[model samples]
Target: MKILVVDDEPDVRTLFEQRFRREIRSGEFSFSFAYSGEEALTFLTGHHSEVVLILSDINMPGMSGLELLRHVKHDLIPPPPPLVMMITAYGDTDSYNQAMELGANDFLTKPVDFTALKDKLHAISTA
Candidate 1:
C-alpha cells in the first residue's frame, strides 16, 4: 500500500519510518512525506492514483489539513478516492466534528498509537 504522510514536523518522517520499518522493508507498505498541506496537494496532483491513504496533521503552516481534506473529498474526483486520516495534538470536539463533517475517514490523536494505526491500516487494506 502507498501512503502519503503530511506534517510540518520533520521528525515525523523519521518516526514513521522507524515505526513501520518492517512493513516497508517487506514491501507491504510504502510511504511518501510532505511537510505542508500545499506540498501534499502538489504531490497528490501528480501521484494521487498511486496513493491508497493519506495521514495528515491538522495544524499545518500553509493551508490547514482540514482545507486539504475538503479538497480531497470534493475537488479531487478520482474513482477510488484515497482514504484520509487526520492527526491532531488538540483532539477537541470542534475539530473532530469539523473533520468528520468534511469527510475525513478517521481521526487520530497525537502522539499516535502505532498499534492502533496498524490495525486500522490492515482493516482498510483488507476491505
Candidate 2:
C-alpha cells in the first residue's frame, strides 16, 4: 500500500519512518512525505492512483490539515479520494467533531501511539 504522510516537522517524519520501517522495507507498504498541504496536493495529483491512505498533521503552517481534508474531499478528480486520518496536538472534542464532519476517516492525537495507529491502519486496510 502507498501512504502519504504530511507534516511540517522533520522529527515527526523521522519517527513515522522509524515506526513503519519494517513494513516499508518488507514491501508491505511504501510512504511518501510532504512538508506542507500544498506539497501533499502536488504529490496526490501525480500519485493519485497509487496512494491509498494519508496521515496528516492538523496544524500546518500554510494549509492546515482540515483545509487539506476539505480539498481532498471536494476538489480532487479521478481515482477517488484516499482515506485521510487527521493527527493533531489539540485533541479536544470540537476538533475531533470537526474533523469527522469534514470527512476524516479517523483522528489521532499528537505523540501518536504506534500500536494504536497500527491497529487503526490494519482495520482500515482490511475493510
- Listing every candidate in turn, what is its Cα RMSD in Å to the true structure after a full C-alpha superposition? 0.9, 1.1
Candidate 1, 1-127: lDDT as tens digits:
9999999999999999999999999888899999999999899999999999999999998899999999988888575679999999999999999999999999999989999999998888778
Clashes of each: 0, 0
lDDT tens readout by residue for model 2, 1-127:
7889999998777887899888778887788999999999999999888999999999999999999999998899884799999999999999899899999989999889899988877776677
Where's the lowest-lDDT run of ten residues in candidate 2?
118-127
How many Å off is the CA of 19 in candidate 2?
A: 1.0
lDDT of 1: 0.94
Model 1 lowest lDDT segment of ten: 72-81
The total number of steric clashes, by the backbone 3 Å criterion, in model 2 comes to: 0
- Which candidate number has the best lDDT? 1
Candidates in order, TM-scores: namely: 0.96, 0.94
Runs of candidate 1 with Cα error greater than 4 angstroms are: none
